[model samples]
Target: MHAITIPEPGGPEALVWAEVPDPVPGEGEVLVEVAATAVNRADLLQRQGFYDPPPGSSPYPGLECSGRIAALGPGVSGWAVGDEVCALLADGGYAEKVAVPAGQLLPIPEGVDLVAAASLPEVTCTVWSNVFMIAHLRPGETLLVHGGASGIGTMAIQLAKAIGAKVAVTAGSAEKLARCAELGADVLINYREQDFVDEVRKATGGAGADVILDIIGAKYLNQNVKALATSGRLAIIGLQGGVKGELNLNALLRKRAAITATTLRARPAAEKAAIVAAVREHVWPLFEAGRVRPVIDRMLPLSEAAEGHRVLESSGHIGKVLLTR
Candidate 1:
């Protein structure tokens, strides 16, 4: 088996595809012959050595993959060999084969092809867990998503709309904003040219966003608070902007808003299993109904994963960049 390994992480050039020993499924796990994997911002951080894989997990960077179950280990059931599945992984989706916990695996959503299904797991679980489960974004509430054209952003837009929430998004360009609008975002702000806090407030009639899904951490912290409606929930999943920020305790208190930050990669298996199950039950049906779909920017050969990383860092892509075997 071959997987992308980082000898000394620095840049995209650090991802080296090389031969490695095949991974065997352990108890409660299954061996998946990976057909495709998709890039995430986390992968970029891992490639730079800022983020390491969880203890006892695969060293490779991918967080989600679409593949077929090749073998099941002891105590794994309800999933059979040769099942076409997409799984949420803590690490190791960059390889041609990965061992996944049975609870993390999901049947490929109806009407989605295997290759594109690679884009679903990470974004779906991220959005569903943060927006729906943690924040409890209700119908008719306004949900603001940063990086509107990103893999998570695109999925968030569609899912929010499907659940009857009003969606708002911020992107750097009109082209990206247009894509967000097409995906059912009601409010689109060009973050480079407009103040998102004002834009979101104005769009929501000054009540502000009922929920904010933010990727930029410190850079948007203050403004995100200002953009929130009373009792709003701000879910921060990425730190692309920076890690530290000054918060206005008075503002947050006045609004009765809450801030929560989480990373899927570091969560316990039971927690991830619960999130995956929620996604499979609530989100998968949206895909089957054609209300949501995987948004892919492009696909590259598995060997060209470095190029895929380059694309993600460029921020020119509208959705996911996939690597296929």
Candidate 2:
């Protein structure tokens, strides 16, 4: 097998595609003949030596992939050899073949092709777990998503809109905000020029957003809190900004708002499996119904994974950038 390996993490140039030993399926896992994988921000962090794969997982760059099952490991059932599936991986989606936990595998949704399905797992699971399950975003509520043009942000926009919620997104440009509007976003704020706290409050008639799906972390923390409606939920999934920030407990207590911080890659296998199951149950049917789809910026060969990283690092893409085998 060949995968994008990092001999010494530095830049996108560090991703080296080279022959490596093929992974074997372990207990409750399956061997997937990789069809495609999607580049994510976490992959960038990993390549820069800032993030490492969880202990005992694959030392590769990708976080999610779509592939066909080659073999099933012991204790795995209900999935068979030759099954077309996409999986949520802690690591190793960059390879020609990867061993995945059976529990994290999902059937390719109807009407979605193999390569595009590679974009679904990570974004879908992250959005579903945070916005829906944890924050309890409901119909008629306003949900604000930071980084609206991103893979996670794009998916979050569609899912929130599908459930009859009003969607607000912050993007760096007008074009990106336009893309978000087409995906059913009701309020689009260009973060480069606009004050999001004011825009969101104005859009919601000064009620503020009911939920905020935040990726910028500390840089936007106080603003996010100030932009929230009473009893709002702010789900923090990424820390593109710095990690530490002071929270005003008095303001939070006044609004009775809640904040949660999470990272999907470091979770236990069982927790990932549970999120995958929830996605299959709640989100997959939306794909089948044509209400949602993967937003892909472009596709590149697996051997050219470095280019894919470049695209992500530039933040020049509207959605997922895929790497194919």
Candidate 3:
């Protein structure tokens, strides 16, 4: 099998395609012949040596993939050889084959191509778990999402709207904002040009947003607190801007708001499995109904993993960038 290996931490140049040992399924796992995998920000961070795979996970960087099952480990049932599926990975998705926990596998929803379905798991899981499950966004509520044109952002917009919630998104340019609007975002703020907190507040008639899906972390912490409505929830899923910031306890106390943060990679197997189960039950049906779908910006050969990384770093894309096997 062939895989993308990083000999050292650096730029896209560091990703080297080479022959590697094929993975075989272990107990409770399945060996998937990879069709396509999507690039993620965490992949870049791992390539920079700032993040490492969990214990016993693949050294490769991809976090999600779509593929066909070639072999199943002992005790696994309800699936068989040649089943088309997509799954969330702990690591090692940037290869021709990956041994994924059977519990993490999700069937390719009807009306979706297996190759394109590779872009769904990570973004859908992230948005659903964070915004709807963790933050408790409800109909008639206002939800704000940062990085509006991002993979997570695009998915978040569609899901929020589907649930009857008002959606607000912040992006760097008009083009990205327009894309978010087309995806059902009720408010689009150009973060590079306008004050998102003020914009969101005004859009909501000075009521502020009820839920904020934030990625900028410390950089937006202050403004996020200021943008929250009474009893609001702020769910932080990434720290693209910085990691630390001061918190105003008084402000939080006044609004009775809550701040929650999490990362998907370090979660336990059972928790990940639970998320996968919920996705299959609630989210998969949306795809079949054409209410939601993967938003892909580009697709490149597996060997061009480095080029995929370059596109992600450039921030010139509106959604997922896939690498095919």
Tell me the tens digit of each residue's lDDT in model 2 across 1-325: 8888999999889989899999999999999999999999999999999999999999988899999999989999899899999999999999999999998999999999999999999999999999999999999999999999999999999999899999999999888988988888889899989999999999999999999999999999999999999999999999988899999989899999999999999999999999999999999999999999999999999999889888888888998999998
Candidate 1 all-Cα RMSD = 0.7
Question: If both were scored by lDDT, which would come out higher, candidate 2 or candidate 3?
Answer: 2
Residue-wise C-alpha lDDT for candidate 1, range 36-123, written one tens digit per residue: 9999989998899888899999988899999999999999989999999999999999999999999999999889999999999999
Determine which window of 10 residues in candidate 3 has minimal summed lDDT. Answer: 124-133
lDDT tens digits, residue span 1-325, model 3:
9999999999999999988898879899999999999999999999999999999999998999999999999989999999999999999989999999998999999999999999998988888888988998999999999998999999999999988999999999999999999999999899889999899989989989999999899999999999999999999999998999999999999999999999998899899999889888889989999999889999999899999999999999998999997
* Cα-based lDDT at residue 291, candidate 1: 90
State how far residue 141 of model 1 sits from its true place (Å): 0.4
Clashing residue pairs in candidate 2, if any? none
- How big is the positional error of residue 199 in model 3, measured in Å on the Cα after superposition? 0.6
Cα-based lDDT at residue 200, candidate 1: 89
- The TM-score of predicted model 1 comes to 0.99
Query: Each model's RMSD to truth, in Å?
Result: 0.7, 0.7, 0.6
**After aligning candidate 3 to the native by TM-score, how far in Å is the CA of 180 from where it should be?**
0.5
Cα displacement (angstroms), candidate 2, residue 22, comes to 0.8
